[model samples]
Target: MKLKGIHHVSAITGTAAGNVDFYTKVLGMRLVKKTVNQDDTSVYHLFYGDERGNPGTELTFFEFPNAWRSRPGTSSISSVSLRVPGDAALNYWHHRFVQYEVDHDDITERAGRLTLAFRDPEGQRLMLVSDEHDTGIAGGKPWVKADVPAEYGIVGLGPVQLTVSRAERTERVLTQLMGYTKKGQYASAIAGQPDIVVYETGEGGSGTEIHLEERSDLPQERQGIGAVHHVAFRVDDEAELRAWIDRVGAAGLAHSGFVDRFYFKSLYFREASGILFELATDGPGFDTDESLDALGESLALPPFLEPHRARIEAGLRPIGTGSPS
Candidate 1:
């Protein structure tokens, strides 16, 4: 099956409010949806992306706190790198982060792209690349700076890098099944990073890039409250996704049967490398439950979770509501 691009990258979050504040206020992404976790009713699932909250532009979070901290090793790829249009815009991000007292690194490079490395409040390793794709993902509150143009601001999430302890299982699934080609192995002294395996859909990885982080320095990260829960790749529809479900099962990897996720249909499995991977069907989209303009204002629950909304809302820890703070 020829894979399209990414649907969204899903990660773990601690609190509803704190997750909202960081994505909206700090990164300038919009809170497109505020919902509860389907598997676990008590926690929230937050989505942050561009104005339309389109596929390939989304970065979702599963709010589950008291999660164990992980080391920066190969058992998973933990960093989520967004993008800026140019070096000047990247410089702006570095300084802007200082306002929040967040530490960041100077500009660096990886897999043929300029990048800035840093950590979030929960130590989720993140980076921002100065790479632009041809599709022209639009609709973010552009970062306004004297030195940077609105268009040159963060274009969207460039790639969510996963550091896995082993590469074989995830590698086969990415190349053979998910349609990612082997780009190359990348090691960057500039970024102070370990050697990594690179994979992506189609050629040149113009849309979203996936890096297999195999750092000998660290071990497999434990997934808990602050760890990235799962990374989702996009599929055109059930027809396209079904092909994947068959392959995953054929490969002898037990996977969840296709499950409807409202905005998309989903299937989950742990790749041989130990990182959790999800396949999400695109569309029915962010507009499914709320109007295009009024996303994230109230709690949204899946049909199954709908019956227990009152109890779930009461159970979650409060998160920042609108904008930062």
Candidate 2:
């Protein structure tokens, strides 16, 4: 079975309120889910995505207040990229960033695509890459309440870049087991970075491209705010997910087995580079527990966590208001 694309990328954030304000108000993505992390029920697990909270569009964060700064090095996801429409959209975003007083760099070319690099309030690196092939207006569905007009808003998630100690191991896992093909490579896209090998999967839409940059000299990364927890790839259904589990076994890669996350089933494993990767099924999506209009309006818990909902809610801090309706 072929892997579909990225389901979501989870990262750590310092403050829930700051994260909510920036992602919703400044970035223009809809906060699709407001929930608690099942594994760690004390903090909030916030989700942001396109209008429908589509699998490829999801970008989630775990609230880790008082967390230290992430130590950047090899074997880490250094940046998350989003897809914008094109040059016009990029220009619009340039102006939007300036208007909102967001810290960002001017447009630049990377692997033949125009990009605007920036960081979140908590120092999470991000970029807006222009997809020349995309015909959809400003990438994809837009959140109606976003400050930027729908046409100029972000389409969805694009390529994610990883810093690895060595590309050989990770490259083998991606090409052989993950149903990905090497698309191209870029030399020195970022200063001090060596060649970056681009791997694409499943017809290659927004979240299909992954760049592996080998930096054997860099040290291992430490966990903190702005650190990426894991990068989850997508499988179409339970059957396909099972097929992947078999594939993982055949490849001799250790996995966490099937996990029921309510919205999706997950199989998490670390790649050769030590960057955590997850194979997540795409069925029974975010809307299963809540209606489209009222999603992220209240806290949601899985069946197991439902019993302690009151206790969990009490421990978590309140999410700020004035978010996208």
The candidate that wins on TM-score is 2
Number of backbone-clashing residue pairs for each candidate, in the order shown: 12, 1
Residue 71 of model 1 has an lDDT of: 45
Badly placed stretches (over 4 Å) of model 2 are: 134-139, 190-193, 321-325
**lDDT of all predictions, in order shown?**
0.71, 0.84
What is candidate 2's CA lDDT for residue 269?
85
For candidate 1, what's the RMSD? 3.6
TM-score, cand. 2 vs. native? 0.94
Error of 2 at 109 (Å): 1.0
Top of the candidates by lDDT: 2
Model 2 poorest 10 in a row by lDDT: 131-140
Tens-place lDDT per residue, model 1, 50-130, is: 666777778888876766665455556578877666666777788888888876888776776778898778777778877
lDDT of 2: 0.84
Clash pairs (backbone) in predicted model 2 = 140-155
- Rate residue 43 of model 2 by lDDT: 89
